[model samples]
Target chain A: MRFSALRVFREALTGHKGWTPTWRDPDPQPSYDIIIVGGGGHGLAAAYYLAKEFRRARIAVLERGWIGGGNVGRNTTIIRSNYLLDGNQPFYEFSMKLWEGLEQDFNYNAMVSQRGILNLFHTDAQRDAYTRRGNAMILHGADAELLDREQVRAMYPFLNFDHARFPIKGGLLQRRGGTARHDAVAWGYARGADEHGVDIIQNCAVTGFRIRNGRVLGVETTRGYIGALKVGIAVAGNSSTVMAMAGLRLPIESHVLQAFVTEGLKPVIDGVMTFGAGHFYVSQSDKGGLVFGGDIDGYNSYAQRGNLPVIEDVAEGGMALMPMIGRARLLRTWGGIMDMSMDGSPFIDRTPVEGLYFNGGWCYGGFKATPASGYCFAHLIARDEPHPTAVAYRLDRFRRGAMIDEKGQGAQPNLH
Target chain B: MLIPHPILGLRDAQEFTYLGDAALIDRPDGLANPEAFHDYLYLRDNPAGIHRELWFHEQGDRSWIVVTRNTVTHEILGAVLAQDVARARGRSR
Candidate 1:
C-alpha cells in the first residue's frame, strides 16, 4: 500500500487498521534465476536494483537473521563522498546522488539528512592534506568547502578549539554530506525489492555451496537445497567464511567495530564532525542522542562484541575532541563485524568460481557506500561487467599491485 | 583481553599491536616464486574459530609473539615467541 498524508489521516480516523507489513516474509522458492546471500542493506539494495533497474525476474535474497540486524543497524549512520582517491570518489559520489533521490524513489521515510560533514584539521600539515582531499572531492563533482578556523568556530563553537596539543586549525566541509536513518535505508530497499517481486527469505542460513567442476550450481541451506543459476555473496563480515564454502579464500578479515549512543539531550551537533587528530566521529541523532564511533577493535574476530581497550580509546578521542560531552551518560553501545580488506577498499567483481560473484571488503565505509555498492553489484551481476566507477575494485588488484589503498596501508586488514 | 606473554606473565592486550595471521611470518621467496608471494600477502584462511595471530608488544618488551586465540570466544589458547617459531621453521637472520 502506498503511504501518504491522506492515507495516514484516513487510517488515523479508522483506528489505523489499514497499515500492513512493509515487506513480505516469503519462503524460499525451489530455485531462482539469481540468489543474493545476506539480506542486509547492501544485499537488499542489490536485489532492489536488480528487479527495478535491470528488470531481472526470479530474484531471491537469503538472510540468516532479520533484516537491518547487521552493521546497517549498528553504524553511526553517517554518509559522505569526500574520499580523496579517484578509485573511490566517483563511486561514492554516485552513492551520494542515489541517497539524494532514495526516499522518493523507494517511497519510504529514510531521513536522508544532508546537514553537512566537517573534518577538522589540527596542524598545518593536516590542513594541507585536507586541502588536497577537498580538491579531490570537488574534482569528483562532489561539493567541498575549506572552512577556516573562524568558520568552524562559528559553526561548532563547543568543540575543544584550544586543546593544548592538538589545536583546531580548520576543516574540510562537505555541504551535501550527513547522516541517514540507517535501519530505514535497509527497510526501504527491502520493501522496494519485495514490491518488485524479489523473495526476501529470512531465517535461512546458507550452509554450503554446490560446486561442480569449477562452477557453482546452487547452495545448501538450513531451509533446504535452493538452486540458482547465478549466486552473489554480499555477506560483509562473513565474506571469507561463505566464499570458503566455494573453495576460495578471500583477502578479507572480520573485526568488531563498536558504536555508542548517549542519553537524549537537546540538539547540539548540527552536522557530522570528525576529529582529525583522533578516530572519533560524531553526530546528533534526530531523537537528540549523540551517536558516535571510532576505530575498529584491532583483531581478527567473528564475535559481535568488542573489548574494553578500544572503548576507552574511543572515549578518550571523544574527550579530546569535545569536552562538553564528557558527562553525557552512554545510553547504549553495540558492535558489528567489519570485513577489512588487504588494501582498505572494497571488491565488487566475479570470483574465480563461475556463476558466483562477490561484493565485500567494505571495512568502515559500508553504510555510506550502500546504494552504489548495491547498484554497481547488480550491474555487474546482470551484465557480467564492472560498473565504470567500480572498475578499480577488482579482486586481482592486490596481486597486480594496483591496490586502491585510501590510507596507503598495505596488506594489513586491521589497519585498513 | 589479556595476552599471556611468554616472558611476562600476563599483559594487557592494549600494549600490543595486532598484525593478523601468523602465516605472515612464513614469507615466501619473492625471487623464487612471485605467485607464492602474492598468495602469502593476499590470501588468508580467516577462520571463525581458532586463529593463530601475530601481535607485536609495542609498549612492553618489543617482542613479536604468536597468540593462538579463539576468534569466536576471544579466549587465548596459548602464546609463544614468534622468533622461536621462526627458528623451528629453520629460518635465521
Candidate 2:
C-alpha cells in the first residue's frame, strides 16, 4: 500500500490497522530466471533495478538470514564520492546522484542527510594531498571545497585544533556528502524489489553450486535444490567462501572492522568528519548518538567480532582529534566483515564460470557504493557488459598490473 | 588475544603486526612462471576455519612467525618461527 499524509491521518483516526507487512516473506520457487545470493542492501537494490529498470521477470534474492542483517546494517552510514582515482570517482559520483533521488524513487523514508563531509588536514603535505584529492573529486563532477583552518574551526569548535603535534591546518569539504539511515535503505530496496515481483527468500542458506562441465546450473541450498538459469553472487565478506563452491578463488580477504556509538546527547556534530592523521571518522546520528569508527582489526577473520587493541587504538585516535568526546560514554560497539580486495577496489564483472556472475570485493566502501554497485551489477547481469563507469573494475586487473590501488598499497588486503 | 611465541612464551597480540596468510611465504619465481606469481600475489584460500598466518614481532624480538589460528573462533592453535619453516622447506643460502 502507498503511504501518504492522508493515509496516515486516516489510519490515525481509525485503529491504524491499515498497515501491512513492508515486504512479503515468500518461499523460494522451484527455479528462477535469475538468482542473486546474499540479500543485503546491494543484492536487494540489484533485484530492484533488475525488475524496475531492466524489466526482468522471475528474479529471486536468497538470504541466509533476514535482509539488512549484514554490512548494510553494520556500517557507519556515511556516503560520499570524494575518491582520487578515475576508476572509482565516477562510479561513486553516480551513487551519490542515486542517493539524492533514492527515497522518493523507492517511496520510503531513508533519511538521506546531505549535511556535508569534511576531511581535516593536519600538515602542509596533508593539505597538498587533500588539495589534489579535492581537485580529483571536482573533476569527476562531484562537489568539493577547500576550507581553511579557521573555517574548519568555525564549523567544529570542539575539535582539538591546538594540538601541538598534529594541529588542524585545513580540510576538504564535500557539500553533498553525508549519512543515511542504513537499515531503511535496505528495507526500502527490499520493499521496492518485492513490489516489482522479486522473491526475497530469507532463512535460506546456499550450501553449494551445481556446476557441470564449465557452467553453473543451479544451487544446493538448505531449503532444497533450486534451479536458476543465471546466478550472481553479491555476498560481501563471504565472497571467497561462496565462490569457492564454484571452484573459484578470489583476490579478497575478510577482515573485521569495528564501529562504536556513544550515549545520546544534544546535537553536536553537523556533518561527517575524518581525521587526516588517523583513521577515525565520526558523525552525530539523528537520535543524538555519536557514531564513529576507525581502522580494521588488521587480521584475516570470518568472525564478526574484534579484539581490544584496535578498540583502544580507535579511542586514542578519537581522543587525539576531539578531547571533548572523552566525556561521552560509549554505548555500544559492533564489527562488520570487509571483503578487502588486493587493489582496494570493487568488481562488477563476469567471472570465468559461464552463467555465473560476481559483484563483491567492496572493502570499506560498500556502504557508500550500494546504489551504483547494485545498478551497475544489474546492468552487467542483464546486458552482459560492464557499466561505462565500472569498466575498470575487472577481475583480471590485478594479474594485468592495472591495479586501481587507491592508497597505492600493493596486493595487501589488510593494508587496503 | 595472545600469541604463544615459540621462544618468548605467551605474548600479547599488540606486540605483533599481522601480514595475512602463511601462503605468502612461498614466493613464486616470477621469471619462471609469471602466472604462478600472479596467483600467489592476488589469490588466497581464505578459509573460515583454521588459518596459518604470518605475524611479525616488531615490538618484541623482531622475528617473523607463523601462527596457526582459527579465523572463525579466534583460537590460536600453535606458533613457529618463519626462519625454521623456511629452512625446513630447503631454502638455504
All candidates: TM-score: 0.99, 0.99
Model 1 spans > 4 angstroms off: none
The 10 consecutive residues of candidate 1 chain A with the worst lDDT sum are A407-416
Model 2 agreement with the true structure over A88-162: per-residue lDDT tens digits: 999999999999999999999999999999999999999999999999999999999999999998999989998
The list of candidate 2 runs beyond 4 A from truth reads none
Binned by DockQ into CAPRI classes (incorrect, acceptable, medium, high), candidate 2 is: high
What TM value does the first chain of each candidate achieve?
Answer: 0.99, 0.99
Query: How well is each residue in A59-131 modelled by candidate 1, as lDDT tens digits?
Result: 9999999988898888999999999998999999999999999999999999999999999999999999999
Per-residue lDDT of A210 in model 2: 92
Cα lDDT computed for each candidate against the true fold: 0.94, 0.94
Q: List the residue pairs that clash in candidate 2.
A: none
lDDT computed for candidate 1: 0.94
